[model samples]
Target chain A: MYSYSEFDEAFVRERVSQFRAQVERRIDGSLTEDEFKPLRLMNGLYLQLHAYMLRVAIPYGTLAPHQMRQLAMIAERWDKGYGHFTTRQNIQFNWPKLKDVPDILDALADVEMHAIQTSGNTIRNVTADHFAGAAADEIADPRPVAELLRQWSTDHPEFQFLPRKFKIAITGSPNDRAVTKAHDIGLRMVRNEAGEEGFEVIVGGGLGRTPMIGKVIREFLPREDLLPYVEAIVSVWNLLGRRDNKFKARIKITVHEHGIEEIRRLVEDRFTEIRPGFSGVDQEVLAGLEAAFARPSLPERSLGGFESAYTNDPVFRAWSDTNVAEHAVPGYGIVTISLKAHGKTPGDASADQMRLMADLAEELGHSEIRISHEQNVILPHVHKSDLPRVHAALKEAGLGTANVGLASDIIACPGMDYCALATARSIPIAQEIAERVDELKIEHEVGHLKIKISGCINACGHHHVGHIGILGLDRAGVENYQITLGGDGTESASIGERAGPGFSADQIVPAIERLILAYLDLRESDSETFIQSYRRLGPAPFKAALYPETAEKERADAA
Target chain B: MSRKFTPKVVTGNALIEGDAVWLTEDDRWTREMSEAELIEDEAHAQMRLLFGQSQPSVVVGVYLADAKAGLNGPEPTHFREDFRTRGPSNYPHGKQATA
Candidate 1:
């Protein structure tokens, strides 16, 4: 984990102080709502459905144990005893008084965390693969580059107010764990023909009302040219991005309207202008950042009770199969602590749960903790020998679900339940789906399915990328849900196409059950996953399952 | 043909606590929609909205919410307004805890 320098520390302190003054001004009626709105948004405050929500950035989803403890403390004291981890790898406190927010920010600054740039039309937090350094398949850690971008984008005067909120994601692995393709700028660290590490820069990819898979503008941008090149892309976007319409203000929209070729030309031109100004200063900074991310050392140990535990304990075996991933180190394993326990709200962690995770991370694993985009916590380097104990601890804390990539591990945003922008409720729907699947006891049997739900068209839950995507909408003041099939959020990413019409909230869970059951029947083999089966057979069967009567009528009409 | 305007209430979040509050006929903030002043007329609704907006120290994001006259006082017509009156569905926090 990267520690904040004196400059970084001072910067955060200054921002907190500034926000404190702004809050005072707003309270005293010196600043109007218009004046205070952008100020509050810049500091990651939002006037949500029930209260003012504060979104605090966990930079690149990485946090030290001490920092995690501070977050727990904040949740206990300031929030309603819990915090929500968002798909963007940030924690959202749904209820925070406007008066207490400044003090809350002061608390955050103490732990080198702040709400700055987590919202509004600014460069949001730079996210990376949760398994960045620890994944066995990774070429290199993407954190150093992510950290560099974080440092660069923070209070960058030139790009403070873009046409729309911009997001960037980077992944170090060939298999994209981070949803890099669904970002305004996606950086995949790739080794060139000469074995020199570089980024395959993908641009204009976003998910909202309009979804687009990012196009690779630069197949291999040298390590040195990264800062300037990225700056160039954003610069081009800032200039040409639509300002007349808020809906079409994203870089994706700009890329779409102007075409990638024209955008590339503009970016290359801007790159030429900005390249000389950097003059290796960023490279020098990156060298220090790379040095700061020290690899954890693990002593050689015997397999010991691991094999025995796997064989003897069925519960432990089930958990280990789903929750554990292969670590870069031989004896080490990456453990994903499921927040999606059966019938609970997705991404919500109680203060006690947060503290428990913090304690476990410090004691068993390294003091490092990562918040994944999938709304789960990652213990990136836990020893395989310690698996049983860790599993036991998680189970005791109600954190053990053994459903990492299963049908029940659903990703849902705080829709109408807490979000002012939400047209319909997402949390309850997600809970219903998970509980229904768990009740049926077919989650593991279904296997490797992603069910992402968004309350509105914003796609905050990355519903566009879910294999079974459910989008909740308000039709004539009633809740309606539309399902999309065959969406993926990996190296082979595809936007899910909608199955015609929609179901009521009451009808949604059963509809999903029917779809999954239909998938089981249509699949060529048990080994074939839901997405694989859908790809093999196409959306015809799934669409038929969603609306059997319509399909039957259409069949009869055809006959 | 244009649709007729529905019954409404002046609603906003409290400036300090940030909890959802409705503007009452007595010119006060109330957590319950039942206590809210139901403005059936468009002009009266606008006036109440203006009144709510004026008190920057009292409330924020002041706007008219769709509502209806009930046996009690005023009731929310939309699910969103009803949600605001109570709280989030997942947890018994916010207004739901105290109410």
Candidate 2:
């Protein structure tokens, strides 16, 4: 994990003090709600239905055990003894009072964590592959670059007030676990013909009302030019991106309206103008940041023991089959801590669980944890020797869910529950669906499914990219959920197609069950996943299953 | 019937557990008493005294329906019983008390 330097410490301390003063002024009536709202939002504090919600950034989803423990303390001391981990890989406390937020922030600063860019239109939390350093297929670890981008974009004067929130994601591997393609800027580390590591830059990807996959603006951007190139792209978007309508304010809409070619041209032009200005100082700064991210030394161990352990322990084998990933280093595995328990809220982690993860990280794995863009926690560099102990601790804490990349591990936003803009309750829906799927134990049979739920059209849940996406909407004051199928969140990312008319909140789970059964029937072979079958048969069969009566009615009407 | 609004309190584990209260007349935090009790309560004096130091602290009471009514409603749901019970339609609110 990247430890904070003196400068980083000073910056957070200063921010906390500043926010404390602001809170005092707001309470004294010196600042109006209108004036204080932006300030509070900048600090990741949101006024929700009953109380205030504070979202803390776990930058690029990385956390130290100490930081995780600090978070647990915050939840225990100031929140509901539980924290909601969000789709962005951030943790949110739903009940912090206005007076207590500054204190909470100070506590976070003590652990080298702060909520500076967690909210606001300014570049939000920089997300990356949860399995970054450990993934066997990684070309290069993306964290160093993510860290560099975080520092550069944090309070950057030019990007302080963009038309809308900007999100950036990076991936070290071709597998795309980070959902990089659905962000404003997606950077995938790639190797050139000369074997020089660089980035394959994709731009304009987003998933609000108008979902889009990023277009490749640059095929191969040299590592040195990363920051300048990013600056150029953002500057171009800021200059030309729509501001007249909030709906069309994102860079994705800008790319759509102007076309990728024009946007690429503009970015290239801007890049040419800015590249000269980035002096050797930038390179020095990046190198300094890179040094901070140097991988922790691993003690060599035998793989023979790990193989034997897996064979001997069925539980361990089951866990390894689903939750563990191949590591770049021998005898090491990337372990994911699934937050999606059967009937529990999708990403809600109790205070005790947080502390347990922190303790486990420090004891068994490296004292580091990474939050996945999928809303799960990761112990990126766990040794095979520590697997059983880690799994045992995780199981005790209710974090040992062996359903990674399966149907039960659904990504959801805190829809109608906490968000002022949600149409229906997303977390509960996600919970119900996950629980239902778990009961069926057909997740493996369903295969690699990505189910996402957004409360509304904003698509914060990335519902648009789910293999089976559910968008919760309000229909005539009733909670209604609209289902979409054939969506994917991988290298070949595609937006889902709406199956039929929406289902009532109660009808949604049963409707999903029907859809899954339909997939099984339509599948060419047992090996064919939901996405594969859906792709092969197209949306017609699924649509027919979803609205058999409607289809029949339409046919009769046509006849 | 109009939309049902859900009443909620803002207190979390950060505050004293029982301090959670429903918003009453003039932004006062009142215990979850009935409408009749709310009308006749003398505790308002003490609450006013306590909350006076905090500006913009008045917790205005509205019907549940008023509070749950969303963006496109006749008026934004504010302290409406109907709205409180039903929750906001377009966005997530009212499903959980904290939200």
Candidate 3:
């Protein structure tokens, strides 16, 4: 994890003081609602359905044990005893009072965390692969680059007020765990023909009302030229991006209007103008960051406990099988703590739960806790021998869920339950789906499947990439759900195609049950996942499952 | 032909607490939806909305919500207003918790 420097510390403290003054002004009636709204939004405050939601940025999903403890403290003292971890790798406290926000920010700054630039038109939190440092297949940890971008874009003078909000995602590995293809600027670290490490720069990929796969502008960009080149891309988009219609203001629409080739040419031209100004200072900064992010040494440890526990304890074995991933080290494993326990709200952790996780991370997980975009917590480095103890602690807290990528481990936005912008209730739908899957006892048997739900068309839940995507909408005052099949978010990213007619809220869970049953019957083998089966058979059978009467009517007409 | 105006209530969130509040006939911002003055006429609803919006520092996002005359006083017609009257379905917090 990267610790804040003196400058960072002072800058954050200054922002808190400024916000404190602004809050006073608003309370005293000096600032109007319109005036305070943007100011509040810039500091990651938003008026939601029930209360104000404060989104605190967990920079690149990294947290120290003390920071985690402080977050728990804030939840206990200021919020509703719990906080929500979002798909953007940030934590949202849904019930902070306006009067307490400044104090909440002061508390956050005490732990070197702040909500600055988590919202508004400026660059949001720079996200990376949750398995960045620990994944066995990682070429290098993406944190250094992610942190560099964070430092550069925090309050970039030239790009503060862009045409619209911009998002950036980077990954060091070829596996693409960060969903790089769906970001405004996707940076994938790659080794060129000469074996020199560089990046494949992807531009204009986004998911919202309009979803588009990012196009590769530069197949290989030397690591040294990252700052100037990225500036050039954002600069060009800032100029060419639409401002009249907020709907068409993203870089994706800009890229759509002017073809990727033209955009690439413009970026190259802009790069020529701005390249000399960068002057290798970013590389020097990166070297310092790399030193700060150095992984702790893990000497060899015995796996006798791990082996015995796996063999003797069925519950431990089940959790290890589902929630654990291979770490870069030989005697270590990456543990994903599932926030989606059966029938509970996804991504919500109580203050006690947070404190327990903090202790667990410090004692057993190298004091490092990572929040993943999939709404789960990751202990990046845990010894295999300590697996049983970790599992025991998690189980005691009702946090030891054996589903990570299973069907029951769904990613859902706050939806109508908490979000003011949501069209329908996403949380209840997700809860019902998880309960149904649990009741059927088919999650482990069903194997790895992603079911992402979004309350609105904002795509905050990454519903477009779900293996079984459920988009909740308000069709003429009633809650309606539309299902999509075969969407993927990986090295091979593709948007999901919509199935036939939407289902009512009452009929949705059963409809999903029918789809899964049909998938089980249609799959060629157990090894074939849901996405594979859908691709092999196409949407015909799944459509039939979703709308049996329509499929029957069509069959009869064809016959 | 244009549809007739439905019964409505002036609603907003308290600026300090950020909880749901409804405008009453006596110019009070009450937390309970049942305490709100249900306006059947469009003109009266607009007047109530103006009254809600006037308290800029005390409230935020003042608007009219569809309602119906109930035995309690006023009932929310939309599920959203119903949610606001109580709280989120998942957690027993907000008005529901206290009530």
lDDT of 2 by residue, A1-559 (tens): 5778898999999999999999888777777666777998899987654457899998888888888989999999988788888888899987777788999999999988989988878899999988877789988788889998998998899999998899999999999988888999999999999999899999999888888889999999999999999999999999887888888889999999899999989999899999999886777877886777777888898667677878898877888889988888888888989999886777888899999999888987778788887888888888898888888889888888889888889899878666756777888788788889888888877777788999899898989899899999988778889998888878989989887789998899988888888888888888888889888888888887887888799889999
Highest lDDT model number: 3
Candidate order by decreasing DockQ = 1, 3, 2
lDDT by residue for model 3 over A1-559, one digit each (tens)? 7888999999999999999999999999999899999999999999988899999999889999999899999999999899999999999999999999999999999999999999899899999999989999988899999999999998899989999999999999999999999999999999998999989999999888998899999999999999899999999999998999999999999999999999999999999999999978899999999988888888899999999999999999999999999999998999999999999999999999999999999999989899999999999999999999999999999999999999989999999998999989999999999999999999888898999999989989888999999999989888899998888888989899999788999999999999999999999999999999999999999989989999899999999
How far in Å is the alpha carbon of A288 misplaced in model 2? 2.5
lDDT tens digits, residue span A1-559, model 1: 7888999999999999999999999999999888999999999999988889999998899988888889889988988888999999999998889989999999999989999999988999999999988999999999999999999999999889899999999999999989999999999999999999999999999999999999989999999999999999999999898888999999988989999899999999999998999889889989998888876887778778677898999999999999999999999899999999999999999999999999999998988789999999999989898889889999999998999999989999999999999999999999999999989999888888999999999999889999999999999989999998889999999999998898999999999999999998888888999999999999998989989899999999999
List A-chain TM-scores for all predictions: 0.99, 0.97, 0.99
Better of 2 and 3 by TM-score: 3
Worst 10 residues of 2 chain A by lDDT: A45-54
lDDT for A73 (candidate 3): 96
Order of candidate numbers by lDDT, starting with the best: 3, 1, 2
Give the least accurate 10-residue stretch of model 3 chain A, judged by summed lDDT. A291-300
Q: State the TM-score for model 3.
A: 0.99
Error of 2 at A548 (Å): 3.1
Candidate 1: docking tier: high
lDDT score of residue B65 within candidate 1:
87
